[model samples]
Target: MAALQGAVETTAPVSRLHEQRSYDPADFGVPTGREEEWRFTPLRRLRGLHTDAPLPGGKVTVECDPAPEVTVENIERGNRRLGTAYVPADRVSARAFTSFAEATVVTVPRGVVASRPTVISVRGDDPAGAVFGHVVVELEPLAQAVVVLDHTGSATYADNVELIVGDGATLAVVSLQDWASDTVHLSHHHAQVGRDARFTHTAVTLGGSVVRLAPSVRYAGPGGEAELRGLYFADAGQHLEHRLFVDHGERNCRSRVTYKGALQGADAHAVWIGDVVIRAEATGTDTYEYNRNLVLTDGTRVDSVPNLEILTGEVVGAGHASASGRLEDHHLFYLMARGIPYDEARRLVIRGFFGQLIAQIEVPELHARITSAVEAELA
Candidate 1:
């Protein structure tokens, strides 16, 4: 479908559609739950983070284990490479930008393909308090790398992450949230994919009092590809949310998003929002996004919304879908018909739901660990 190929300029912003872009915190103001973006979120669990309360001393300690060839730098606020990939899009992200005292930058030099993953571990300290952090990952042209970000323990944390993959580069990012039940985390992640580059972002959320993560991707040039995958489990009294946006402003770009979640016990809540925009000039764009949720028990809630806006019919393809429901009785019945016990049958169904995405993870150790944790939750 090349109906509108190269027919219009891509820089014009329509005033009717509310755009979520700004470097100033005041532009977003304070979220009072009445705003469309913040309506699904529980602001009370944020512990005054959205307001003017000053960020306390850091309670989360961060350490990086880089590959032998990689370079890790703890830079000051004004470093030249800090904001190249992303900017603050909301009040909390803007606040994180203004509050963080220092920033961490990890650089993968041009054309260096890493053999081992660059792991960054963030652990919470005792006497948990509010914490703010910023991390920037830069990959030069033709570089290939896998970066893992692990979060554990407990704290009230807010952070911003920026990922830049240069032209002809390949980058895979895995971010896991394995926090204690008392922890609350809010984060914004932005990725800029260069010409003919490939980028994959995988997020796994398992434990938290309230966790909301926003991931946005934009192409710096045409011929870029982006794949976003996520898996989450919500237990009793837990809230987990994931919001994503993929902007297709460049021609010949492609994106695919798939996220699955399971909920059990009372008061478990999960929210997923997938948004994709295809501009008139982006004629060769191909995009699809979908989210699925399985409810394992009563008193659980799930919200899934998929939105697609296409300014031109010239694009190759564009579509979105969302589904939420309890496990299929036929799936469990099929296993039980084979003489398997009821508990084991239920577990198998949940495992099968997540297994497909888990298998996509390239790290064997992380794959085994995540499978074990999912089993523990089912137990």
Candidate 2:
């Protein structure tokens, strides 16, 4: 019954509770690992973010290089522009809402197409501290822009990101969680697509001791479109999770999600939860989500779940798929028989699996960097 009418998000996945939005942290309860949303997560490793951990500022730094047509500003908390496109959906998210000192706002003027991609670099210098951050991106009507959020270094971080795509605009956001091995990160991303607008979100998570990313989308008017693509790799003793929600509340809107992941070494774990909801008002809605995982070694864990909730069947179609298993022997054998060494063949197989998705990225530098990082992860 996932073509959902209402549901709440948590650390583990999307739960069946009625959805609620709030800026107050006290409105959300600390997850005890027993709730549906917190079941698959390791709560102890969250650095108390789900509980009472102090969300200090200045522990992490954010730098942005915007295109000539774009404007970037750092505004203090309580700014009206900060939460217009976002709402706290979970405990860590609520905590982040109350903890961040300043929020970064990036705006693309109406009808202006950005000449270059905006690059926002976030780095944590202290592994012993915790940080909270917020970022908002607004694309005015008919504007087109691409934004990249890059995370690195070590720290316990919780952050929220908001994207507002105005009518007829097209916006793409690429978020990378290439943190240090000892880092822990919790992030929430929300996008509001206006009438006839198009939005694309890409999540590339490759590092960190624990990384949990939740990205959700909602349509403001009819004919909106959304596309979500992601790829992640979990190594030994690492926990990487992604939770996605697509709320089709407007007529004739469409959404598509495709996520791929690879796991290796003992204690390497990955989780993917895709939730697509076609509300009663969302007639002629079309959506599909699929997730695939590759197991590179024994002693690895993969949890993949796809949920499609259709409130009104009067329109288009909805579907989802999830699968996880070891590398296909036939594919490997076929490559090896082509005179390719076993190691080279294995890497080639992985490259084929993720290359297509990465190719969709419009940013050349970020695209090349992710390709190199994927190669390094395989090596």
Candidate 3:
């Protein structure tokens, strides 16, 4: 973990992270090679990996053209608006908020409608130390914006991001991860929604030696809405995991999540765990979650768990679903009999599984890019 620490210390431009509590790997629970959640996961994959350390310069090359519709700013507001919150104090004594000294803050002004999608590219060049980066996004009332974050690096690193949506605002965020083969990636995303606000998040993971993504979202005000979507593909000897939590704390709030993944080749594993909680006071709330996985090879494995807890029966709707299996022979046979090749038929099915989530995105360019990425992975 010294490598991770060094990255955060030197690369992170924000200054306030030092004030917040720090996080230790043991705080989340060590992999016993026996726990149900860690059953399908291969903890041995992380053996001999470098410890988490800080990056040298805390400088990452961002490669994306600026957009005219959105405004990107830098902030060090000494406020804990975007930082760690869910970690138990007893297990971890890390700061709640750590600002990257060279952080980028994006703000969408009230009543503004961004026509083009904004792209933020974070590229890491250091191979020895961890790189800590923070991005805080705030949307004003009645504003509509679309933001895309792309993370690419040559070395192993850890990144943290925080997002806040104002009342009556609409923000769609799409994150794409394409790391190098020797990279180890860990990301934490926290979002807070206000009254009548709408937040939509879609994540696509395509590359990395070991990748863990955690997205925690909460509806803190009335009439807030959140939709979360994710897709991942793991090939030979790769390990990918996605963990999500959605909390409804206000009345008349709504949330929906759908995530799908595909694993191929020997020793490849993918895991998805989704948890949704409706508090006692959150009446008239509606929430639903679903997770599905497609195993492409005999040696590949997938684990999916969808859970929901409701405290009040007065809520409108609450449900969860999970499924993990291989491609259906009947469907493949039907396509093959119709003159389509078996390989192409399988590709079509995999595309359809992920296409469901990509279709929900409103940005045309982003949708095309995600679709193309998925197709390329299949090819």
RMSD per candidate (Å) reads: 5.8, 4.0, 8.2
Error of 3 at 140 (Å): 1.2
Give the alpha carbon lDDT tens digit for every residue of 278-356 in model 1. Answer: 8878889999998888888888878787767788788888887677778888888999999999999999999999999
> Candidates' TM-scores?
0.94, 0.95, 0.83
Q: lDDT tens string, model 3, 1-379?
A: 0011001111221122112334543443444555433454455553322222222443357544445756776656344544533331111112112324555777778888887878888786765544555677778888888888887776555556667888999988888877776566666676788899999998788788777776767775899999888889988878888877787779999998888888888878677767677878899999998877787877776666665667788899998877777888888999999999998999988888888788887667767877887787778
- Weakest ten-residue segment in model 2 by summed lDDT: 1-10
Compare candidates 1 and 3 on lDDT and give the better one. 1
The C-alpha local distance difference test score for the whole of candidate 2 amounts to 0.88
Task: Assess candidate 1 and give its lDDT.
Answer: 0.85
Q: lDDT for each of the candidates?
A: 0.85, 0.88, 0.69
Clashing pairs in 1: none
* Candidate achieving the largest TM-score: 2
lDDT of 2 at 188: 91
Best by lDDT: 2
Error in Å for residue 281 of model 3: 0.8
